[model samples]
Target: MKKKRIYISEAHKGGRELFYIQEVFKDNWIATEGPNIVGFESDLENYLQEEVHVGALNSGTAALHLGLILLGVKSGDEVICQTMTFSASANPIVYLGATPIFIDSEVETLNMCPVALEKAIVHRILLGKKPKAIIAVHLYGMPFRVDEIRAISCKYEIPILEDSAEALGSSYKGKKCGTLGEIGILSFNGNKIITTSGGGVIVTKTLEQKSKAIFLATQARDEAPHYQHSQIGYNYRMSNICAGIGRGQMEVLDNHVILRREMHDFYVNLFENIDGVLVFNEPSADFFSNFWLTAILVDETKNGGITREILRAALEAENIESRPLWKPMHLQPVFEGYPYYGAKVAETLFENGLCLPSGSNLSDEDRERISKTIQVVFKKEIKNS
Candidate 1:
């Protein structure tokens, strides 16, 4: 019999998840408003230290769009975003008809480069248009250089939109990732640490921001009994059913973080002795990564010219799923015309990086099979060299 295929990430839903969903159905509260939605938001607020108000939304993209709206980003304004992140980080910029100025990543954290960001800010200022906000992401659950990024934002007097979509359980200096910026976004997509099936939240520091986000997300309904509208709005509220899933998922969130860290350790141990393999890890003690998806960089110079693609193909032959790191946004055709700043760090990372199988529920058999395939590829490459 053929072995089971191991994927890079997968949602782990149990009876508890289903039980919550059933409760929502039994109560006939399947729409966007319900006790589950309130409970989930409260749970997140407490878990994240209550420093920020949380607004449940349909997806992380919705959270980002609302965050930009809160930041006063509008048509013709420019927003500085980390180029090495998922496109969602930049797509919201275009959603508001604002341009995104892509900043490259640093090699250590594979996140926004502080120096490049400052350079971009100054360059934009000289062009007579100061960027309205900065969108820095915690890529792959690894926190960016929070201190440095915050300092730069403060110096420039620019607000930050922290995209913690893949970093809900991650932290920097003991503070949660999603609470670091003026406004933060989280994703509960099936692939994230805690799956709401599909949902997200926008986090902010004040009631006004929270209320405004809620208003804007719910079609900007004015205070009236009948249908009313005073401004533009969106249909981005999370369904109560989905919020129930989120509530249940929150119950096991800490456990999920622990399992993800264990997976990271496993990859670290497996690749420690491999000459050309470099596991992507927390840059320092200050950064606590959730290790959402364990990734590695294969240095061809040290690996006798063997490339990441070669190993990716070998793993594919064994029915193991992996993926190349996100290509820098500046390289994407849709974002090509935008301005970009920094050296080739992000470009190099894209050239050699690959995500490994890192599902929190992966079995020992899955690990052994994956490890064996990788070992075989490296062994053959060494032999050929």
Candidate 2:
């Protein structure tokens, strides 16, 4: 018989999703336009503690596309992006026929390094082309150096699309991630802190921006007695059923963040005495991460010759799932020719880091199984030494 497999991050239900779904079905609001969408957006606005506008969409990628569009990014333009995140963060720049200038991450946050950002900006401008916008990401729910990044954006006079897709409940200096930039986006993908099944939301500081996003998302129909259009658009609005799920997820968002943080705490204690495994965490009191997916950097030299890949393979043998960190975009074949700035921080992270199981619904038994499997590998390494 096969052992039970442990997933890295699984969608957790809050028990209220079904109730909300029933409400949507009962109200017969099966399309994208319905009360659920409004309720979900309102819930997010209240939770984020900002008077911001929210536009729900089909996926986080769509939200990014809309953000780039609203930032006036067009063909032949350039957009600066963090290289240490999922490709969604930079692909939108390419979607608009704009080139992405990938910047490396810093050691502290595993996010975009501000020094590299300014360097990229200055060099791009020196070459007679100012970047259309900046796409800063908070990778793995860890908030980037928000203050420094924002200062660079202001100094360069460029808009920023804050990619908070993996950082919905994360915050920096007491402010929510999505609300910190000119255009912010959240992902409710299955592997995220909260799942709307599959959806995303755009956070705008003004109603006009929110209105513009909705117009573009719903096929850019002009207000008329009959369907009219003057601009190209996309079908990216979230369905009512999915919004109902989102609303339910919102009710438990804080609790989910807490649970994910607890998972981080679990890794902290588990690796405390271990020589080579260091859990990724907040650098100071100012940054509060949702701890969406607890990651670790394994120092093979210090830890009995066990590398991240060795640890990952051992876990897989135990029917436990773990994954490597995102490969930096600049190193990807698709983005090779684009300009990149800064040191090898992102490369180091990718080479040594591994993501553990961090689902909110992970039980004590699951933790025990994970801990035991990890201990076995480390013990073998120690014995060999």
Task: Encode model 1's per-residue lDDT on 1-385: one tens digit a residue.
Answer: 7768898999976527778889998999979899989999999999998577999999999999999999999999999999998999999999999999999899899999999999999999999999999999999999999999999999999999999999989999999989999999999999999989999999999989999999999999999999989798999999999998898899899998998999999988887778898999887899999999998999989988789999899999999999999999999999988999999999999999999888889988888888888778877322110
Clashing pairs in 2: none
Off by over 4 Å in 2: 380-385
Q: After superposition, how far is residue 247 of candidate 1 from its true place, in Å?
A: 0.8
TM-score of each model, paired residue for residue? 0.97, 0.98
lDDT for predicted candidate 1 compared with the true structure = 0.92
Model 2 residue 109 lDDT score: 89
TM-score (C-alpha, index-matched) for candidate 2: 0.98
lDDT of each: 0.92, 0.92
Candidate 1 lDDT at 272 equals 70
Q: Candidate 2, after superposition: displacement of residue 304 in Å?
A: 1.4
